[model samples]
Target: MSEDAEKIIERLAQDLRAGQFTPGSWLKQVDLQKRYGVGRAPVRKALEALAGRRLIRHEKNRGYSVHPADTEEADQVLDIRVAIETGFAEAICRNAVEADIVELGGLAAEFEKIAINGPFHLLYDANLAFHGALLGCARNPAMVALVADLRMRTSPAPASQWLDRSRIERSAQEHYDMVEAVRTSDAAGLARLIRDHILQRAD
Candidate 1:
């Protein structure tokens, strides 16, 4: 893909991640073009790229649409996440600095603050920011990108994951615990926490 196309793909993917488009909703080329302020070619290329990534679905005459939530698929993706993220704990703890811990703590606090009454999107964004920062501590961009793509595949809409305010609050506390685990360089503890956090949702 061309540089322009790559940029468009990232932009469009971010929107998809943010739930800008509902799952199973059709993506019109004209709407995408207006949204990204790009020409037809780049939008088309971006859609094709995303489709290849399994971020969206493509049909013969229907063009592209978001993948609707699938329980089995989501569970499988969550299994992959637990493996990757928990395995990454040691590296993350080794590479994390005070600054990284502080950043994570701040993000965790932000999420906790909004867990009870904030708008769903903001709460979701806060949760994403916290995890993105946590993953960055590992200093593995490739792994981080893969995890992000997997997350989008499993949970196309953030609202679907929130479920209830109590669950959201539990997730918020887990974020703080994750930061603390990093701070203490408790790799094993972090791994357990990561596994529990990912698997608890499926319970």
Candidate 2:
């Protein structure tokens, strides 16, 4: 993909994260073209990319619209995330080096700092980085690809539901626990921690 297309995708993803695009609202190419000051090609490419990730839907007559959020779908996504993260944590526990643990610790510290800050966007990126770091520790290309797809699918959730500082703090603590479990080579503990951590966020 060209740099412009990549930028368009990132901007659209950010808007989706910020709830700028409401569920079921039609996204006209012309409107997006005007909003982003981009040409038709990049806008269409962005929409197609998001649609491929199931973050948006393209209808025969409606052009494109944000995907409707469903509780059942959210539950399923959470379940998948738990399974992937548990395996990731276990892999890290079994094979992670000192440098891997150090990197994970750094990501955890970043997450804590973001939780201390009021702006949720920082928290969001930190959360992504924490998980991305875990996936990096796994060092499995297939697992990383699957986790990336799942992460994109779950990224458009309403920020209002995740605005509680206490909840964010709890998540940060869970990241710490996960890293400790990996450092100690506690595979079972890492798995349990990941399962509980994901389900807690689903609540």
Whole-model lDDT for model 2 versus the true structure? Answer: 0.77
Instruction: Work out the TM-score per prediction.
Output: 0.87, 0.85
lDDT (10s digit) by residue, model 2, range 111-198? 8887787566666667777877777777887887677666555546546446577888888888898889888998899888878866
Instruction: Write one digit per residue (lDDT tens) for candidate 1, span 58-126.
Output: 998879998886768778989999999999999999999999999999999999888876866688778
TM-score of candidate 1 to 2 decimals: 0.87
Candidate 2 wrongly placed segments (more than 4 Å)? 1-3, 117-120, 155-158, 161-163
Clashing pairs in 1: none
TM accuracy, model 2: 0.85
Cα error of candidate 2 at position 199, Å: 1.3
Give the CA lDDT, 0 to 100, for residue 181 in model 2: 87
